[model samples]
Target: MQIPRWPIATEREKELIDEVLASPHWGGFHEIVARFEAQFAAAHGCRFGISAANGTLTLELALLAAGIGPGDEVIVPAISFISTATAVSRVGAIPVFVDIEPYTFNMNPSRVQEAVSAKTRAVMPVHFGGPLVDMDRIADVAARRGLIVIEDAAHAHGSQWQGRPAGSFGLLSSFSFQNGKVMTAGEGGIVLTNDEALAAKMRSIANQGRRPDATHFHHFTLGTNFRITALQAAVLVAQLERLPAQIETRTANACKLLRLLEGVDGIRWQQVHPKINRNSWYLMLGRVEGGAGRDEFCRRLREAGVPCSPYYPHTLYQNPLYRSSPCRVTPCPNAEATIADAFWIPHNVLLGAGGLMEEVAEAVRRAILRG
Candidate 1:
């Protein structure tokens, strides 16, 4: 089957790039950056947006803005991109690793409650692979424990839970515009918040602590430069225009593929809750069944022309860097089991025609049978 290419650049992208190239202000202060920030935030039902150089820096900035400093602890999922845990360390806070739901690949809310401690100040739940975490449960825990909620929405561009957008449920939410993300500008990120004061603080931190109206080289607080370029923002603006339609296409294709795989042995797809109104479908996650090794299954699927991968071979705590990092760990059986079985089909494949989904299902069956 022919799979569609990702980060599809059209005439609109070219037009936007040209505009940024011709403009005098190519820096972060450019109007184009502000426009992209506003537009992207509004799309996710956020009141304000602050653009940054990269996704990791955005999380650090959010931590800083929230006053999560040394000795503070932040609860995080055991299975996620390294940044989810490292971001807490970068801000001088320890990450408390919690188990995930085997099927959803998101942090188990019950585990979150167990991980909380006197030092716990916040919870950072990642909407892993475009499916929103259980925000309702996370919120209830946070409210009772007096902990803040910061969403790691890097994989959930247009996902929603119970009709609420992914970024809107948390006190602060971060999004990545990395090359592989559903939205891409090569490298960029943003933070969204409903609180005007928090938004100003984040902007200041990303702008080297300069006050919004400062005309001189004045620094109010300790901050660093995590600014995004006008060029990247221009590209993001163009990409944003394509997001809604792309999300719809991906979701439709995912549904078709899931239906085709129904009752099929040797495979189990992610179990999305009914409350999840829309899933971004960044990657269609599935687990190998019938005793096939995850890597072998992925190898055979690739040979059969299926764009698949065995993602996250191990939990984040197992990484060498985490060996010395100040993080609290607990046994996460679900996360460990998922690492042994998870496989992913990239979102670009879902951009293909509905018939291509049949080809994908067939490829899966072939890979399993061959194994």
Candidate 2:
């Protein structure tokens, strides 16, 4: 059977689209967009939310709102998707690479502590795939050094740590509603923060820098048109409503698969933190062990009709963009190691019923045995 892939849009999404089309205001000016902004923000325990066209822009807008500019350095985990680094670059700031914890696939808090230079203005901690970073440790370090925390919660919607929502910890946090994310609107993002001033600044920067109450053609600061449409918001609101159930199914599937693969010697799963009350399970990550080839194992799994692939092939600092840019490039052996061996099962496949997860587990077992 063909395993389901990302963006499992349903009748609810279509109905929302129809509702949007029937309305007079279809762009960012509609009531749906306003309601989505408020509801999504409140759901995450943040007082305000600013919708954006994409997650990367959300990060850039947040940085800009936090006054991150040229010469300001933001510490970023080396193991994240390239957007984490690119967002810093887009804001004319430097991204200082910090090594990740190989098992958790998140930035090592000690390395973050060491990477903070005099020019450091912020620390962007990415909750890679389904797991959260050691926010407590990172927060302590940031507090000691007076650094702004901008969480990259692209993969962490509906995820909580120590009973607090993922996006609520940072001065600013960003979430993606891209096609493959935990919640999707085809393409959209939001920045959440309790700081009213920061939220207002981000909103202004996203909307061409007009004052929140301004009606005239007056530009208050440097900004761009990064606004998300009412249609995307409508779909996202529906997705948000469905997220809890989706997360539950994915978690159950992940656990079952983990149990089935317990005796496998050549594969290991990502370590979930004890404090992670919920995991959105955007990608079920595993590492190839014992010198086994990651590609070969993934090939076997795919041959068995279970889709799988290696995670990011390269650490962010290893990319040519960082090579050419004028930024501090640090050694991240942990990130390098993690990227070289990591493979992921897309969360969408786990959404299926009818013993699909058992099939995935059997596929991995057969692949490991063959290896």
Candidate 3:
């Protein structure tokens, strides 16, 4: 059987969706959405959760809620999804691209410090695939500089570092429930924060700038429609129930896959920071050394029925959107090289029990031979 690339919903998700559809409150106004927001926030050890239409918009909401806007500069990792930087730009702030650690594929804190300036307002650290950035280091740097820290935790669902969960580290953190993410709600996102003021702002911004006590027609600020429907929330509630087990399975399978590939030469595994206690394992990133081209390696893996592709084809700054937009663009040698050498295995493929991980290992060994 072909390994599935996206999440496969079970009967629970179907039943939840159906239940929501049968309810009198069918839209985002339903109580299920509130329950989902509360449950998701509590799970991540956050005081508040505000649902959004998608992760990208959630980032924008986070930025706006934090009072980051025009003429402000936000330090961002060069290696994350384009949404990370785009959100800053959408808030009318400049995104200063910081190079990543060559091995960890996460932001280099030193580079983040170097990128700071009088206009700098915040630092958005992304928890890349397997391990998170050193949050303590980043937090120290940001605290000293008086810069706000926002976490683009779209790839991290149940990940934790040093006993602290990923979403709890930053002033504001955003999660994606896109179909490809560890947890799926088809298309939804949520922002988390412990600060009650920021949480209230985020809620208002997501709901067309309407205040809780304001008149029905009275608008509070320039907000957009980013509310997530109750149906989506219901499905996510069911999906959340399975997340712990899914993460456990993925972590175990990843360990087995690592052991299997340990003897294989020329395949460099991504380094996991020691502080990471539980890795969500959004994907498994590896580099092909010994002068093997990443393209050829990915082709071989595909040929072996093991789907693999570059974590990102290019650094976020290299995208044409940034080139056209008036944002700070800088060269990140490490990120540039990383995009060229990276190849990843989808996390969902590890869901199957039995010899699936062994099959993955065998495929990697075969690919190396072809490389």
Candidate 4:
């Protein structure tokens, strides 16, 4: 049997929704939403939470709240998902592309300092592939340089760095609740911040730039109608309850595969930085060693009753947008190198059984030896 990347919801998800349907609260502004916001904020150790339409809006609003808009340059890692750069561009800010570390897949913090200049307004470091960035180092640099730090935490839910939660490190953090994430709201996202004023600005900015019940129903700061349905919040609340168990299972499964794949030739393993305690193992990446290539490796794994890919073969900067952006993609040489090298595999707990991950790892070991 093929191992699915994300299985259908367990019974708990349905039961939670049934309870929501039976209740009076449904919209995001309702009491249940507040409950979720409070619980999430408490979990992340943040002072305020503003749930938005999705991860894209989460960062977009965050940019606006952090006072980033036209002509300002927001430094972004080229290896991350496009939304990272788009969020900056959405607010009319120019995205200054930066490189990423080959092993950690997080932004190269040292290089980030070099990228900053007079036009630089904010540094948005993405915790790519569920690895935590060295936030303290990044923050110190931001402080000295007079820049805001925003975290694209789409992959790092429940991840920790030196006893601090991933979302708590940056000036503001963006989270995704799309179907594939650790916690899925079907379609949800949020921006968490310790800064109360910034949080308030994000809230109003995300909701069409109007204060709730303001005398001027007028849309004030050139905003979009980015609001998640109450149903999304209700569904997310259910997922949030199961998150601890899910993360535990995912982490364990990732460790199991990591150990199993170790000492195997041709499987380039991703290394976590020492400071990261709880890694949100969203996807496990493997590079074909020696003569074996990513395409062939993924193909063999798929044939072995495992849905191995949906590969992110290269960095997002190699994409045409950045290639043609007049700024040039070659500037971030390391980011381009890291992105061109690997393919992603299913990190699903279920994939461990059915000899899936083991089989895939074994196949790569064999292919590299034979080829």
- Per-candidate RMSD, Å: 1.1, 1.3, 1.4, 2.6
TM-score of each: 0.98, 0.97, 0.96, 0.90
Per-residue alpha-carbon lDDT of candidate 2 for residues 1-371, written as tens digits (9 for 90 to 100): 55776787789988988999999989997889989999999888999999999998888888888989898999999888888999999889999998988788888999999998999999999998867798999999999999999999998998889888889999999998888898988899999999988888887788888896777489998877998998999899899989989999988888887887787788878999999989999888888885358888888888998888888878888888887986786788878887778899888888878878787777888887742
- Model 4 scores worst on lDDT over the 10 consecutive residues at 322-331
- List candidate 1 stretches off by more than 4 Å: none
In candidate 2 the C-alpha lDDT for residue 242 amounts to 92
Using lDDT as the yardstick, the better of models 1 and 2 is 1
Candidate that beats the other on lDDT, 3 or 4, i.e. the better one: 3
Which residues of candidate 2, in runs, are more than 4 Å off?
Answer: none
Please count the clashing residue pairs in each candidate, in the order shown: 0, 0, 0, 3
Best-fitting candidate, measured by lDDT? 1
Candidate 1 lDDT by residue in tens digits, 1-371: 78898878999988998998898888887899999999999999999999998899999989999999898999999999999999999989999999999899999999999889999999999999999998999999999999999999999998999888999988999999999999999999999999999999998888888997886499997878999999999899999999999999999899888888888887888989889989999989988865357788889889988888897978999998889988999779989888888889899999998478889888887787752
Q: State the lDDT of candidate 4 residue by residue for 1-371, as single tens digits.
A: 54665645767667766766777866555666767777887888898888887899899888888888887888888777789987887788888877877767778888888888898889888887777888878988899999888999998888898878988988899999887787787778889999988877877777678876675477776666777766677677777777777777767767766777678666677778888888778777655544236667666666655555634555666666766553323267656555445666655643355565576556555544544
**Candidate 1 weakest lDDT stretch, 10 residues:** 286-295
Shift in Å, residue 106, candidate 3? 0.3
Off by more than 4 A, model 3: 1-5
Candidate 2 similarity to native, TM-score:
0.97
Superposed on all Cα atoms, model 4 deviates from the true structure by an RMSD in Å of 2.6
Highest TM-score: which candidate? 1
